[model samples]
Target: MSLGAKVAAGETRFTVRSPHAAAVDVCLFDGTAETRLPMTRDGNDWTLAVPGDLSGTHYGYRASGDWAPERGRWFDPAKLLVDPYAIELDRRFAYDPRLSEYGADTADLVPRAVVQGALPVVPPAPPRFARGGLIYELNVRAFTMLHPDIPAAQRGTVAALAHPSVIAHLQKLHVSAVELMPITAWIDERHLPPLGLTNAWGYNPVAPMALDPRLCPGGVAELRETVAALHAAGIGVLLDLVLNHTGESDVHGPVLSLRGLDNAAYAHEPNGALINDTGCGNTLNFGHPAVRALALETLRHFVRHCGVDGFRFDLAPVLARGPGFDPAAPFFAELAADPRLADRVLIAEPWDIGPGGYQLGQFPANWLEWNDRFRDDVRRFWRGDVGVGLLATRLAGSADLFGPDCRSVNFLAAHDGFTLADCVAYEHRHNHANGEDNRDGHGENFSWNHGCEGPSHDPRVNAARAEDLRAMLGTLFASTGTVMLTAGDEFGRTQHGNNNAYCQDNAAFWLDWAGRDTALEDHVAALSAARAARRAEFAQFPQGGEWLAPSGAAMTVADWEDPASDGFDYHVGGARHFRIRRAERSAAI
Candidate 1:
């Protein structure tokens, strides 16, 4: 809240926090000209004030101090560093070798943060998304890139989401909230540009608050308007945020914002090497008060200014790690105590590639977690690798994982893995296009090819795949607790086995609206309607139920454990019944 350019009555105040810097300067840009104003140091903060409201003015910062990378100090005044609290940018970040060069002047390379005036704050309201509703996860750009109804100019931006066609599609599926993948500004990995690839997923963020100009050129107002429109249509908006790391990356990486202003913002080993908890070069030091403050302000900014219902944190374990992940971390306690964030829907992608990072069900009782176990076990079940017992356990809310409360967000597939359609059509990942020698995505996907790999022209193979797709969708809807369906999955979108399509910004990743499988979509719509009609039963684990065999008799222990057993009928409270037959590849409620 105390950082970045703030415009108030009759004047504008520029503030930045750089604890290790000897001095800091506010660089103002005007077309082809520039002016640098010295800021007075106040403790760890640098402050400057200019007469008149400087709203819409472009600005950046330069901090001068020790330039020791090995010792965790990277102070470079030549680099035009972005404001850590930047709310908007005039351009998108582009990766360049000069950005990482110590003495290179990057004023022409880095984006300038635009000074914003006072924004209209949305009135506080309870989130539209409920704990047990459907969350439709999507990549904003890829989701609408090929939509026929959206105007060409708006196809790949946030404003496109407000289109009538998009809303109608979401309504058809009974989506409670649309979990938009990262819309914040991000930079491509250093290795990507040369390979003619970009970060299609905005996970490699530098400025936490700034919205990417390419994605939302209208900035805060654009997002606020889209949120209002979705809310009007009975859908909530949940932003997927990456606060764990920045694109600044390792010591060999660039000196953008935090890295240039205050290297101490990143977690470092005792000997001064940067910690790689996020597998993204650097891990933010949440233990630092400044880092925590920036995170809280970022969340509040979205809720207060943009009216977003909640957030789903990427690599969430890093937020709890003060060197090691702690369920009782201060960040959790602080988040709960904050009046603005306390009641918001908080979901965690509860794992990272760090030490002791797999803390699946260890989040706060009030929080929900992404259940990869459900994803894997359910796939294994339909593939005939697991018996009915495992599938039943997942359908019953994975009490073994989440205890009695069932705080699981059960999903069949998400944006990071194979699509629901691809799961039935490809047994192996095809990620050669990622330039990683096909070793990028998960090798073992718990998938099957139905006697053929990739696309098969055989009618029988296609029929089998379609049936399996419906079976998985049925199982997801029948499972207890919250459920999420990745966009394009409900209608059979495929990436041709490219499980890791983060770098594929081409048509391969775009949803083919014209070619969608309507029959499968209709089946999903029916599944949604059925779940909604019995919302109470699906919202929680059944207190009492009858597990019946296909012959209309009670299921015995032998039936549950038998590998050959493939189907069961569950009757809940003598009112709601679920029928699932793996042999027939059919499930109905």
Candidate 2:
């Protein structure tokens, strides 16, 4: 811990917490070649005396110790292991069982070597994030794929996010934080690739700390630069963290990172079998102390090294669930108390596939959740279903869901489901592209085809769909609670009939840089204009507001259920809509 012992000009001192490894070598690489230097063990630490390795040197770890799989140690001297703190990766991981510990289970494959910054990692981010902050959800690839101004080399990577075009786009949108889909290193489901598809959105996480090579431009600095640019624009970046489960497929899944490092720590399956909660193959058990430590360390590492402003937990409720998905689990409470994460902008997906798993308003006040009810209601109303009264309840922040203080994150669409355009153009999910035979997406989209399915030449139908788009997005941005608009929603991008294109690599999911509709663009502009006008007049976050329902409609759960009886109905879709009134009581933001 002292600088008295100086390192050579290119030589660096290194340490690891593996006393059991008979020998540890620092495998150094200078972009092209690699050299191995041995490390000596002293007590619990292994110290490496490298021969002057430069900053950009690519490197990995080589440990000579136990190689037993059953006992949980898979150290192989032949394999060049990647450092957990790697800042850069050379390539995206291909979904091969060779990447896994077993043949196909992802819970077994470890990460590849990457270059990290030479400076020491910083401490945790300040525990400070404003409540009622507007969150913008986006997928890294989709957000910039069609951007004309973004450089082709940087497009779709973390570097693309920092481009002026991206920054300008977000500023225009006016959302405070950007909730990015899982950026951590992950692998697409094997079925998709053979079907000629790529995992467009990274939901299946392999290594929580490793950056997905596909999205990395240079290294951690690529992320740092992107975050810095966003901060300069007064925007925060909230990573959609995947902790509930891993990319590791079912019992026949691959063996990647954690499965190789310590499967017992990361894998949460009871009796070493998969739990279907995450809908992913395996889950991370909160019961293990090491798992908790590693998870916490991973979070701390991200905040320190990556400059992430906040984390949107993919399956936050799973973190709180006990042995049997109990609500008051220690993990949630622990994260709430951890100084590292307490004041962070914690958002949750709020539900998993587990039994009794949907806890909409159950999370504590510190956390905001993806309000599925809001999406359903708004979609129902826009799609012109009957009984559309509940639209106001959702637009009013779902007091039914959020209660006295907690606010729900309401949205019309997100990365996981149907896009706003698809919500109207397509009636049912077209997930045949995902190789699940159309069974991958939800059947109940709550979307209407407006008297016609798919695209139409009838200007009336087009006009109707356009109106529906405005109504939904307008309501989302103009509502109470923290609003989260998906990346492509603003431009009214459509995924054709592919509602659930989780694994479509082709042009089907990519943003069409050339085919933008001007009318829809104006609609998006109007939505932003409304939000900005209101936001400028009323203080953001925590200051009160009264959405004085414009039509002078009073909202209640009863009225929302039956639209014809009241003015509107969110469930069956109706005619009447409600508005709000802002209370600008506080001057201080």
Candidate 3:
């Protein structure tokens, strides 16, 4: 039987895989009335079929069995369990510990799943982007929260992206693809409400398939319409999905969906404690066939129902961590063989906090990886600590780390770190507002404050910072692989030195639409155009490139060893060449 509630042949059927449940019931709601129907079990799956169409019906699951936290068997019948494959949700999940307690009933506070019709099928279209294209990553909410031109009602929703102002800005940036942060439904951290904070980055997901009602009030149809609008404008959409873990934190966390249905779906130790590989309470159990099937089902849902162009997997290494990291994992092979995801893009974060987790360049050939090496090395070069030789390697595509067939996704800063402007103005992380006593965020940012911390009014200081920003942008564009720019980095967006602004969703994380450096914005646009044209030219002439001295001779080892060496040329065969040079504390493209 297929998972989730599906309608077919004038009847509605509810099927769920509960491997260890002794009893399962489907709780159907009609207005204020509630009806509980017993489910028939065969092996591990439970099935319940009704005689009429349940198109507008809402329902949930109740699995009853032994409750042994230490043994990892959490079966709370009082708690209404959500279907892992629910396409539509009636309300957001409200957190209450009683829902997970062994004998407490919290039906009124739980969220209900709505039965949806089959997804509409559309003719397949060619991908709008390929490797070596620029990707602009932005959160759907923060990107338009303060936009002056967007309508008041649609300001921070998915529909805002289709506005003329938003589309025009993306067009001007010349970005080939737009990577949106997670739009799926998520829960706040267990301790957040008490501390007066909320999950803004959407990394703590609870439901992988249902759209967050707050972000998309218009539901899945709105998302489909938005995708169509972007495709019409020649832009592709990539969603940042969280499949490695769920919002169900440690054993003390709420019993929302997965845990109540089957605790075995999560990774566990020999003692049956949850595995903390993802640093997020529970790591998914890819070792189980049913867990892997759920992941595949979610991927196909987004591609076939929502029509997204690609996916950026968060904490991706967890998917292949079968005892240890394996390149030929079952899920990877399953994805490669699936015809539904043939032309869709697939990118990975490439690392986690678990042992043997940093598997950079170890993914399958079809996947692109986030190059932390490129990000750190480039930052160090611009900070004046590293020399041009290191920059040369990164600019040429970090061949030391990646195979020739795998493309690198280079970036300087992303949502988790300080903004581009903050990178040059803050040497220390100022995360006092995050309520962790300044103990949160990364300690080693490889940043420089240029003789001052935070903001400054000195003309010489401002001028120096401005020039360094341009040089770094120029270097990124001149590099040979795909590049990604944060939402407001082009015009010097700042977060006041908060490196980890994931919890600071206010002005610190939102983009300032009105206050932009027009000059810097124009410079970014020009660099993007140059990169596209240069990439095309390099494809035709793949060889005959070498390092050259500033004096027009082949560079020697002694030249590279010189501490004061500020510039060198990457001379292509024939008369073509590219240069990154610094003179008098200012670099030029």
Candidate 4:
């Protein structure tokens, strides 16, 4: 709130935070020409006032100081840095070797932060989404790029989500909330540009608050209008945010934004080596007050301006890590105390590549977690590698993992891995196209090929795969607690067994509406209706339920422990019954 360009009266004031810089300059751009204005230093902040209203002005920052990377002080005036508080940009970031060069001028390569005028803030209201409802996770660009009804000009943009056909499909699935993948401004990784590939997923973010111009040409207004449309259709929106690391990357990485302004914003060891808790080069230091402030401001900005319901944090453990993961971190306390974010739905991915990072079911009581245990255990159960006991535990909300309350967001597949269709059609990962020699993505997927690998022309193998998908969907719908279905999974979308398809921005990752399985989609709709009808029962674990065998006899411990046990009937107080049979590969709810 104290930083960034703000217009008051007839003059515009610009403020930035760079405690390590000896001096800072605000670079104002008029066409191709630039004029640098020196800012007054006061403690950790720099301020400058310009004459007249500069609301539509494009500007950047250049901090002058030592270029010592070993001591964590990287202040290079040659590399023009973006504002950490920028909500809009003149263009999207592009990868350039000059960005990391010490003396090479980067003014021509970096994106300029556009000074925005006042924005309309949505009135405070309770989130339209609730617990125990379905969350449909989707990639905005990929999800709409292949849709037939959306206009060609609107495809692959945030405005496409507001299309009537898209809303109709969401309404048909009874989606409680649509969890959109990152729409924030991001840059391609250093390696991708050389390899002729790009980071299709927007996980590698730079400006935390800025919207990517490529995905959102209309800026904040585009997002605000889309949110209003989804809300009007009774579907909430949740953004998947990446606050753990920036696209600036590691020691040899680019000198952009925070790294150029104050390298201390990143976590460093005693010897000044960057701490890579996120496996994404460098991790943000949550211990720093500035980092926490930026994060809080970002959350409030989205909630106030765009009217988003909540956020799903990617690599969430970094948010709670100061140097070590702590349950009582100040960030958590601050988020709870802030009135703006207290009521928003918080979901955590719950793990990272850091020390002691696997904190599943350890988040705050009010937060929901993506339960990988549910995903793996369900996959193993259908693959016949595990018995019904493990499946039953996941179905009953995994009380063993989260105690009595159910905060698990049960999901079989997500954007990062193989789709539900691929889970039954591939025994091994087929990611040779990723250019990593099949070394990327998870090795053990707990998948099966049903007597045929990849796509098959045999009708019997296709039938088996379809049956397995229906059974899994039935299990997810019948399970307790909130559930999530990745976009296009309801209609059998496939990434061709590419578990790590973050770079396949082409036809490989886009949803094929023309070739979608309509029968499977109809089955999902029916399952959603059934869950909605019994919403009360699915909200929590069923009480006084009897587990019976297929022959109408009570299930015993031996039956549950038997790996050959194919199916069982669950009767909840005789009001509702769920039948699952593996022999026929069918589930009746």
Candidate 5:
């Protein structure tokens, strides 16, 4: 019996792609009693006519095979498997070695969630706003965990997104979108377990189709309500999707959902063992037909079923990379043609931590990419790196990177790095607090800690830092790419230089709403509004922008500064804070 049909509430139908397992059994648990039902084989798919209706039944597949650790054949019949189509979860997973035959801790993991009804019926995905739309990237738990205004029950849940206080805040702020960090099911690393840290920025995805129950108070309904409310407020929701890899870490990793389903098909490999190209171990192989189908299925699931406006692919370069890393891989072409996904925003991280993997500005038309170059260039310039003398190109639109083909997802900071506050204040990564002895986060941050290493009492340094924040944030709003705002970076959120706060679910990652920085907040609100107005003006760019500089001739700093030069700038600049006028007339982009 296939897990999908079983979860649809009829007699369970099971299928397994593995021709290797000698025998397969579908075991059902009713809390008190356990029933073992043997499956009849048809090729590799086993048919089971289980007698019972299971709406919320707990189950696992028992395959006949030796528990051979050497050959990597781990078939434990005693272990209870989770329903991949389960609409509801049994309970929050705790990292425990007992969960698997091996003593590795896979607890804080996502129990295989179900697809509920077969084929997974979903509401139509809404239209995606343009590149100029504002995105508020945040952790669901941290967004409302400590808010005073959010109801106690709703705090830190998907319902918190629609809470009056949240709505009031986002609506008042005038942000066009909100990006939830890893709302998909995820698992925390074993080392983070003792520190009581969780997968705060959920890169470890357990189920691509299912929402992490931890983020929703009333499960799927609550998540649906949150999405609806955000739409009602005119805010589009973008999910941070980890399609480059899965929750399963390595061969030593646990037998999680995807690993158990189709190991060879779904993951990458070099010399037979799964390749850890994403640095998160077990990269999903989009090269495989079944894996590609799963990837397409996952996207369809979100677009049609989840009602999300778009997806931000984490480590997206791998998705485009094929047999090796090919920018124009069939995977991209397939998505580009998928009518269901064609309209929704497709934002890629554009690079993976692998050899020959960093592909920027290479994606097809209509896709938006996270421009790491923007972040690096902006940091280098603000830090007084004279090497960054050529930012006028980037500040203008990064046409060198994304060109006219695709728009860029530009920003100064993201969830995986130090917040803007830390970038200007701390010279090195401060991850000792992360329990990895300061060896966890990235050290090559291209950051310049102006006159201090962490927080300082010096007014000169602090004021300069504030100005730098404004400069970067200002540059982001001022640019032509799609700006993705890391949750509290607007108001000087600091991870104390802890770039990777995937764990540390506490205040380290959460937005401390009660403790507001009035001045920075106001400045951000104004800057964001200005950026938005300019974006609207330049919505249909090249089409809207008047030519300031000719294609062959170099645009100089003097021309940019000289107000007297008939040289008007195409950019509308900020609403009030700044303005630029171009000399010649050109079409909008």
Candidate 6:
């Protein structure tokens, strides 16, 4: 059954799926007044149809059944539950202890699904993503938060991204796609408000289908319009999604939506303890048929209604965890078979903190994965490590890891870790402002501070840092797979050494366009133009292309094993490297 409130000719239908609930009713709210309509049940689905137009109605569900957390079945009728398939929300959800308590009726404290008319029918054009192109990853809010050209009212919002100034920056760099960090409806972690912080990354999603009001107040239509604007400018959009876990935290966490309606939707141990595979309290049970259906529907809604070009799944191993990580998981098969999504770009973070979690290069051939091996090897090479041969392999493409059939998404820095500037400025993470006494971020950053730990006024130290930064960016663009650059890295943005700045929704996370390193910016642009011409060269080569040495001779095992080698070059038959090469200077531009 199609879930959520759908309106048609003079009739409106409501449907919900919960296998364990004994009884269910749809709750309609108009200020302090409420109307409860009992729904007819057929197996796992509860549905009802009314004969009048119910287009802007605020609605939720109330299920009556047992409340036993020890056995993982908590169904409290008093707690109003938001529909999982809702396309619109009346407002953003605010946290309250009473909303999850056993006997309290908290109807007024939750967000309701709006009974929307029909979704627009603007089909997406053929995907703009090709074999090898640049991907610029950015947060919708932080990217333009400090831009002076955008209107004051539009700053830190989705509407600001569609501004001509923002699009022009992307066009100047020849960006093939803009991968926006998670924009789905999410909540701050339970401990952040008291610490005077909020979740800036939007990774902890509450509603997979609904966009966060703080990010996009104009709702789905606003996002659709933004997508259209980017498409007209010849740039594609990719959404980072959190499908591994919900904002409803641990056992002591709140029962906002999924936990309130059906605890069975989440993964559990044989003893009924919530499986914490995501390291984010609880994980979704992809083995369940209903849970799988919910994930599928969420993907389809974004494609059919939002017109997105692709998705990057956070903690992707959780989706394929059947006893352990399996490349042939049901979800992977479904994605390959779906005509609407097969051609669209699909990327995976490729690892989690669960058992057998580090399954890099193990995903199906159809999906592109984040190559952490590439990240580490590139960092070590520029940091003056001794393994030049290893760096050569990564630069050519991690053929040893992904095999010849699969492609990799090569990136040196992302949102979770330090920015590219911080990678060269701090040897260790500095996260004391997170209120955790600098104990929250990763311990091993694989960075080098050149001379000093933080900012240095010494000209020699600053000069050395700038050269290393150029070399890192140069190596990334000179590779063979798709490349992603953090939004502020082009101008050398820094988080002041805070590697895990997820909780800092302040200036530390926002991109400051006012002060930028213009020289580094130009060098990045030059590298991008060089990469654009190189991508067409690589694409012309057939699968299993011929490999050769820099002297245009055949490559050998010993040639690949030479540890003293600095760099090697190969041609894709007739394809050639551009003449605009990096110089051995502090200021390469």
Model number with the top lDDT: 1
Reference-based TM-score of each model: 0.99, 0.82, 0.97, 0.99, 0.87, 0.94
lDDT of 1 by residue, 459-520 (tens): 99999999999889999999989999999998999999999999999897899999999999
Ranking by TM-score: 1, 4, 3, 6, 5, 2
Task: Arrange candidates by lDDT, descending.
Answer: 1, 4, 3, 6, 5, 2
Q: 2 or 6: which has the higher lDDT?
A: 6
> Considering summed lDDT, which 10 consecutive residues are worst modelled in model 2?
580-589
Candidate 1: list runs displaced more than 4 Å: none
Ten residues in a row with the worst lDDT in model 4?
573-582
lDDT of 1: 0.93
Candidate 5 lDDT over residue span 176-263, tens digit each = 7888877766677655678867677778776565667777636666666678888888888888888878665776666665455446
| Model 5 residue 525 distance off true place after TM-score fit, in angstroms | 1.2
Worst 10 residues of 3 by lDDT: 535-544
For lDDT, candidate 1 versus 5, the one ahead is 1
lDDT of 2 by residue, 1-589 (tens): 2111124566666654454566877666664456788877777556766555445555566666676654546555655555543445556666764554422222123344543435445456553235544677878888777788988887889888888877877777666788888787777776666777777778887656778877875667678777878887888888888888877666555544444334554444445455667778767777765456556767766677676777888877668655466556677677777876667777888888787788888877677788899888766655445454465566556777776564677778887778888887878877766777777778898887877878899998988777667666666765667777777777778887777777775666777656777666666666665655556322222233332232445445554465453232111123222232112100011
Off by over 4 Å in 5: 1-3, 6-10, 51-53, 66-72, 83-87, 99-128, 266-270, 387-389, 540-589
Model 6 TM-score, 2 decimals:
0.94
For candidate 4, write residues 1-589 as lDDT tens digits: 3899998888899999999799999999998899999999988999999999899999999999998888888888898999999999999899999989999999999999999888899999899898899999999999999999999999999999999999999999999999999999999889888778999999999989999998899999999999999999999999999999999899988987999997888999898899999888999999999999999999999999999999999999999998899988899999999999999999999999999999999999889999999999988888788888888899889998998799999999999888999999998999988788999999999999988889999999998898999999998998889999999999899999999989889886799999999999999999998998888787787679999888889899999999999888889877445888877887778
lDDT of 4: 0.92
lDDT for each candidate structure: 0.93, 0.65, 0.83, 0.92, 0.66, 0.81
Clashes, model 4: 0
RMSD of 4: 1.0
Specify the poorest-scoring 10-residue window by lDDT in model 5. Answer: 580-589
